[model samples]
Target: GAGVSQSPSNKVTEKGKDVELRCDPISGHTALYWYRQSLGQGLEFLIYFQGNSAPDKSGLPSDRFSAERTGGSVSTLTIQRTQQEDSAVYLCASSLAYQSTDTQYFGPGTRLTVL
Candidate 1:
């Protein structure tokens, strides 16, 4: 089965611009999550989705950050009016289900750099 995949592994963008990062979860996995880890910091949860239910977007840093999961699989995280603080590794993970203790396998991540 295919593991989670993210494109442009590294992205360099200008401040105040918008960028979209894509994620493809593993096949048959029912849960997907987005997290960001700043330099020397632990992972910060951004959003999570399970099946066709409403996604949990509580962890999004600000209104400028938004995401959507489609067909219970692929998801896209979009940053509107990107800021310097938004430069970090955007990681995507998936588990068999949306359980608090479920182990999540992570992708190499898309590193976004705001210039």
Candidate 2:
């Protein structure tokens, strides 16, 4: 009955540093997603994982961004050489399935600030 959760509610880092954000999706959910919201901007999809299918990395902004889901449960998003523009709230969501109409439960995001 637990909902999606994220760690390190806030993070501050210097430009060029690297950061890793973690997420735990709800039990029994088979689809997970990562998204980012910059200051004053809308949510931008980052990546998606569904069951054993290959992850969809199309939403990643650049090579500096990457993520992985293990055992179809926990997930981590890694940012390499963080940039000032990377400051944003990284959100994670999960659904029961990967259907387009399925409702996604969102997690409290991890806020990253790059100085």
Candidate 3:
């Protein structure tokens, strides 16, 4: 059984450039999540997807951030007109069920550096 994984371990971009971070959740997991961690800060919830239900995106920082889960397996998080403040490590996680009490397995994360 594979654990959650992310791509492009690291990224460097101009301040206004856009970036896409990808994630692959473990098989049989029905709940997926996206989070961000700024340099020394704790993880910040960004979005969540559970089965066929609508995604929960209330945690997205602003309009520049968005994500999508395809086939209920892989997910991508995109940042439009990236800003210096958007520089952080983007993490992904998945759980066996949608319950808030379920344990989430985390990915290593994609680090984005906005210059």
Q: Which sections of candidate 3 miss by over 4 Å? A: none
How many clashes does each candidate structure show, in the order listed? Answer: 0, 0, 0
Give the top-scoring candidate (lDDT). Answer: 2
Global local distance difference test of model 1: 0.90
Measured on C-alpha atoms, candidate 2 has an lDDT of 0.93
lDDT of 3 at 75: 86
TM-score of the candidate numbered 1? 0.94
lDDT of 3: 0.91
TM-score of each: 0.94, 0.95, 0.95
RMSD, one per candidate, in order: 1.2, 1.0, 1.1
Q: Lowest summed-lDDT stretch of 10 residues in model 2?
A: 51-60
For lDDT, candidate 2 versus 3, the one ahead is 2
Model 3 C-alpha lDDT per residue in residues 1-115, reported as the tens digit of each score: 7899999899999999989999999999999998999999999999898964545678999999988887878888999999999999999999999997989999999999999
Q: What tens-digit string does per-residue lDDT give for candidate 2 at 34-109?
A: 9999999999998899974545788999999989889999999999999999999999999999988999999999
Clashes of 2: 0
